[model samples]
Target: MTLRKPPIPRLLLNNVSCMRNAQQILRHVNVSVHDGGALVLKGTNGSGKTTFLRMLAGFTRPSAGEILWNGHNITESGVFHQYKLHLNWLSLKDAIKEKFTVLDNVQWFEILEGKQGKSMAAIELMGLGRLAKEKARMLSMGQRKRLQLARLLAIDRPIWLLDEPSVALDDEGVKLLEYIIKEHRKKGGIVIVATHLPIEMEDPMVVRLPPRFPRRMTLVDMLDRSGLD
Candidate 1:
C-alpha cells in the first residue's frame, strides 16, 4: 500500500498542562513528532510518562492544552478511528489473552481488526515459531514479550506508542526489538516510547519530565525498574 504524506507533525501537543490529585504533573509542555521520528520519554517514576501517554491516547483529559493530529485538534473525535487508523500501542504487561494460543491470539487480533497475514511468518519473525501453538498462559515471560512484539509486526501501524516494550525480554528478545524498531523507522513510522532502557536507535529524541517533590518511592523506582541503570 502506498503511504500518505504522513501529515507532517503526526502528533502535536500545544501548551499541554496536566494535573493529578490537585498536583501539577505537566506544565504547558509543547512537543511535536514528525514522520519517521522517534521520541523517548525518560524520567524517574512519577515523571508522568504513563499519564502523558494516556493523554496522547485520549484516555485522560489534560487540565489544559490541545492535542493535534495531522493539523486537526484531537479533542473533537476523542481519539477514535482517525487517530486509530495510524496508531498502535504496546505496554509491558503483554496483555495477550491467556486463554488463547499464540497463533490463535494473533488470529483473533487479525479478525477483530479485519487484518490478515501469514501468522506463522509473523511469529517466526519474533522468534516465537516453536511456541506458536502454546497458550499465552503457558508461555514464559520472555515468550509473552515476543507475542506482544508480534502484534506490532502484524498490525503495521504508522504510529507506535510503546510503554516499556523491553520489559521481561531476554537478550535475544531485546535484539529482536531493536531490529523491529529499525525496520519500523525505515518504513516511515513514528515511535513514542516511555522507557529508560538503553535502546539501540538512531538519535532518538529524549524528553525528561521533572522530579516530583516529597521523594516518592513509587515515583523513583519505576524508572529504575526500566533496566536503564
Candidate 2:
C-alpha cells in the first residue's frame, strides 16, 4: 500500500468583474492562491480593492465571472454560508461592541461561531492581555484593531481576507501584524490583504487594480451603493 498527500485548498477568481450603478469598478480580474500562500492587493483609491474583498465574502454579487473554492463554484452551489465557515474577513470596521469588555468581545465571537471557551491565548497574542477586562470603548483605535485581529487567532480558519489591516497601526503594531500573517501562512493558511501601507512578506503574490475615473455620484449615493449608508 502507498500513502498519498491530501489535496491543497485553493481560491480562484476567474475574470471577476464588479459594477455599481452601471459603472464598472473591477474588470476581468483573475487570481489563484493555494494553501500557505499570500496575495496582496495594491491600488489607488476607488480601484475596486474593497469590492473584490466584498465579493469574496459574498456580501455582494459580481456582475460577471466566477469565484471558485477548491475548484467548486461557491455562488452556483448555494453554499455561501458553508464556504464562509472556512474563511475569516476583517473589513474596515472593527465591528466591536463598545459596551463589551475586551475579553467578553472575543468570547462573544467564539460563541457566535459555535466555538467554546474564551480566547485568552489570542488576547495575549495581540498584546491585549493587560486590557482584557477593559471595555472596548476604552481602548484606543489601534488597540481596537488589534482586538479585531485577535479574533482571527481564536477561530481556526484556513482563509483570511483583510482590508486596510494596517490602518491606524503604529510601528510595533505593524510588526505584530506581520508576524501574525507570516505565522498563519506557515501553518498552511491563506491570506489576502488590501492596504495602502506596506506589509513585509516573503515574495507575496501581488494584484494591482487600475484606477477608475470618478463618477458623478453624491457622497450619500456612494455610501448607499456601497451598503454603508
Candidate 3:
C-alpha cells in the first residue's frame, strides 16, 4: 500500500489594488502564501486590512491585478466556488445564532453544509465547554468572540482568514488563539490574520498598510488644478 503526499496550496496576489468611492484603498499590494505559512496584516483603522482579507475571500474583486488560488485565478469561471471550500473565514461579525447552544453553534448540522468534524477540541480550546449547553446569546462579548473563532476547527479547512480576531478577546483568549494557529500551521494549514493588535506567529510574513491621506493642496496647485468638464 502506497501513501500519497498532500497537495501544496498556494495563494498569490499579484500587484493587487482596491478602490472605494473613486479613491484608492490598497495600492499595488503583492502577497504570496503556501501550505504551513502565515501572513500578518497590520495597520490602523481604515488602512484596508479588512479590505485585503475581503479580496482574498472572493467577496469583492480587486480594482486591478489577479488573485490566484493554487495557480488558478480565483475570478476565473467556477474558480471562486472551489476556492471557498478551502476557506475558514472569521469576519468582524460573529456567525453565532443567538438561540443556539454554544456547542450547537459550532456543530450546526443543518445550517452548515460540509463535512462535520468533532467540535470538542474547539470547545475545550476556547474554554467554552462549561457553557456548552448554554444559549449563545447568554455569553458575554469575549465569549461570543471565542465562539466565533471556534468555527476555525469545525471543518478542518486548509486556509483561515481571520479579521480582527482579537477584538473582544482577553489575554488568555489571545494566547489560545495563537496556540491554535501554531498547531494548524504545524499541520500544513495556512493562516492569514488582519488585525490592529499584534499577534504572535512563527516567522510570519508581515504586510503593513499606512493610513491614506488626501492629496495636499497649495496655492500654486489650486491655480493649476483643472475644472471638471
Candidate 4:
C-alpha cells in the first residue's frame, strides 16, 4: 500500500508581542515558515526566544497577534490539540527519564507517538548504539543530548521546536546534529530553534529577537501566570 503525504505545513506569526513582569520582551514580531524551512531564533537571555517558541507550540498565547498553522489560528482552544500532533518540542530540559535505560527512553517515546521499528535506527544515527542499554542516569551530558535527538528521530514528527539543542554537545556531536537537521529539512520538516550558540543548517532563515525589554515586572505578568488575566 502506498502512503499519502500530508499537505505542506506553514507557521505564521503576525504582529506578535510578549510581556513579562509588566515589561515588553518582544514587540510586533512577524515571521512565516513553510515546509522544508528552518528558522534560527537568536537573542540574549530574557529576550523572549523561549516565549516565542512556546507561542508557536500553543503553550503560550501571544500578547496581541495570531499564530497560524496552515492558515488556521493555532491559539484558538479548538485547534491547539490538533496543531501539536505534528510537533516535536525540545525544551531547555532534555526530558530524559533518568530511571530508564537509553533504549527504553527512546522506545517509550516511539510508543507514545505510535511509531514502530524506528528507535534502534535513530539510536544508531545519534551514535548511541553502543550504549543503548545503559541507564539514562549514567550517560554524560552530551550523550543525554544525543539521546534526546534520537527520540526526536524515532518519533518522526514534521514540526520541530528546539531550544538550545546544541548546548553541551562536543564538536563531533554538533556535526551530527547539523547533519540530522539538514536532512530533516530536505524531507519538508519545519524547524524553529532558539539558541545562543550557532547552528549550521541548510539555508536557514535567521530571526533576531528584539533586545530591548522592560526589566520591571508588571501586574499583567503576574495576572497571566496566576490565570487571572
Candidate 5:
C-alpha cells in the first residue's frame, strides 16, 4: 500500500469582468492562488475592488469570465452554494448587532452555525476577552473591528475574503489582524484582502486594477484639461 499527498486547494479567475448598470467595473481581470497563499487587491476608488471581491464571494455575478475553485467552475448554481460553505466574507460593514454584547455576537454566530463553545476562544484571540460583556454599541471603532474579525477564528473557514479590513484598526489591532492571517495561511488556508493599509505578508500576490475611465470627459476634453503649454 502507498500513501498519497492531499490535494492542494486552488482558486482561479479567468478573464473576469464585472458590469454594473451598463458601466464596466472590472475589465478582463485574471489571477490565481493555491492553498497557503495570499492575494492582495490594490486599486483606486471606483476601480472595482469591492465589486471583484463580491463576485468572488458569489454575492454578485460577473458580467463576463469564470471563477474556478479547485479546478471546478464556481459560477454554476449548485457549485456556488457548496463552495460558499468553505468561505468567509467580511465586508466593509461590521455586521455586528448593536444591541448584543461583544461575546454575544460571536456566540450567536457559533450557535447559528451549529458550532458550540467556539466563541470564547476566538474572542480571546482577537483581544476582546476583556470586553466580552460590553455591548457592541458601546465599543470603540477599533474594538468593533476586532470583534468583527473574531468571526474568522470562530467559523473555521478555509477561504477568507476581506474588504478594507483595517478601516478603523489602530496599530495594535492591525498587528492582531496580521497575526490571524499569518496563522490561517500557515494552516493551508487562502486569504484575499482589499486594503489600502500596509500589511506584512510573505510574498503576497498582487492584483492591481487600473483606474476607471472618466465618464464625463471625451478624449479631446481630456487633452484640453492636460494643461500642456
Candidate 6:
C-alpha cells in the first residue's frame, strides 16, 4: 500500500515580513494551516497578531514573502475578494452597527452574504432569539459578543481567524465559542486564533510570539532556530 501524504494546507504564509512606522511588526513568518487542524497564536498585546490576520485577509500587503492558498500565491493575484469569500474573521471590537437592531444586523449580514434565512438561524444558534429585536447598541457586552458569533455560524467558511474571541464574555459566551470551534474542527475546518491565555484545546499545535525582539528575523526562522519547526 502506498503511504498517503497529507493534502496541501488550506492556507500558507511563506517568509512574510511587515513593518509599521519604521518599526518591524513581523519578520519572515511562515505558517501553514491544514484542513481540520488548529494553530494557536500566543502573544501579548501589540505583538502583531491582528496585523498578521489583516495580511491574511488581504487588508495589508506583506513587505516581503508570499501568501499562498493551496500552492497558488495570492500576492499580486489581485483577487482579494475571492480570498475573502473563504475566510471568516472575527475581530476584537466585534463591530456591530449601533443603529440596527440585533435582528436587523444579522439580517443585513445574511443579505450581504447572500445567505437567506440564516439571520434567524444564526440568532437561534447564538441563543439570542429572545433579544433579536433589541438594538445592537442596547445589548450588553456579552450579548454583543453573542451577536458577533451568530454571524460566524451564519457564514460558514473553511477558515476561521479569531482575535481574542473570549473578550468581555461570561462563562456562557466562552462555552459558546468553545463549542463553535470544536464543531468547526469536527467539520474539518481550519482555525487560527490569537489569544493571551492558553485555551482549552485537545492537542493543538501552539506558537508563542515574544513581545520584544533582539534582532530582525522571520517567524519561520525563529521557529527553526528554537527547534519548533
Error of 5 at 117 (Å): 2.1
Query: TM-score winner among the candidates?
Result: 5
State TM-scores per candidate. 0.86, 0.87, 0.86, 0.87, 0.88, 0.85
* Candidate 1 local lDDT, 21-119, one digit each (tens): 777888998888888889888878777888878878778888998888887777776555588677788876666899899998777766767888856
Note the residue pairs that clash in candidate 3.
none
- At residue 221, give the lDDT of candidate 4: 88
Per-residue error for 204 in candidate 5, Å, reads 1.0
Candidate 4 whole-model C-alpha lDDT, 0 to 1: 0.88
| Window of ten residues with lowest summed lDDT in model 4 | 209-218
Which of the two, 1 or 6, has more TM-score? Answer: 1
Question: What's the lDDT of the predicted structure labeled candidate 6?
Answer: 0.82
Any idea what lDDT model 3 has? 0.86
lDDT of model 3 at position 57: 93
* Candidate 1 error regions (>4 Å): 1-7, 215-229
lDDT of each: 0.83, 0.87, 0.86, 0.88, 0.88, 0.82
214 in model 1: Cα distance from truth in Å? 1.8
Residue-level lDDT tens digits of model 5 in 132-207: 9988899988888888899778988999999999889999899999999999999999999998778888889998
Clashing pairs in 6: 27-218
Off by over 4 Å in 2: 1-9, 215-229
Of the two candidates 1 and 3, the one with more favorable lDDT, higher being better, is 3
Per-residue lDDT tens digits for candidate 2, residues 1-229, read: 9989866448888998889667787789888888899999899977888987888888878899988887887896467767888989998888899999999999888888898654898899889999999999999999999998888788768899999999988999899999999999999899999987899998799988888877678999989989993
If the candidates were sorted by their TM-score against the true structure, best first, what order would they fall in?
Answer: 5, 4, 2, 3, 1, 6
Clashes of each: 0, 0, 0, 3, 0, 1
Residue 184, model 3: lDDT of 95
Residue by residue across 114-201, what tens digits does model 3's lDDT show? 5555676778778998999999899999999988877678767889999999988999999999998999999999999999998899
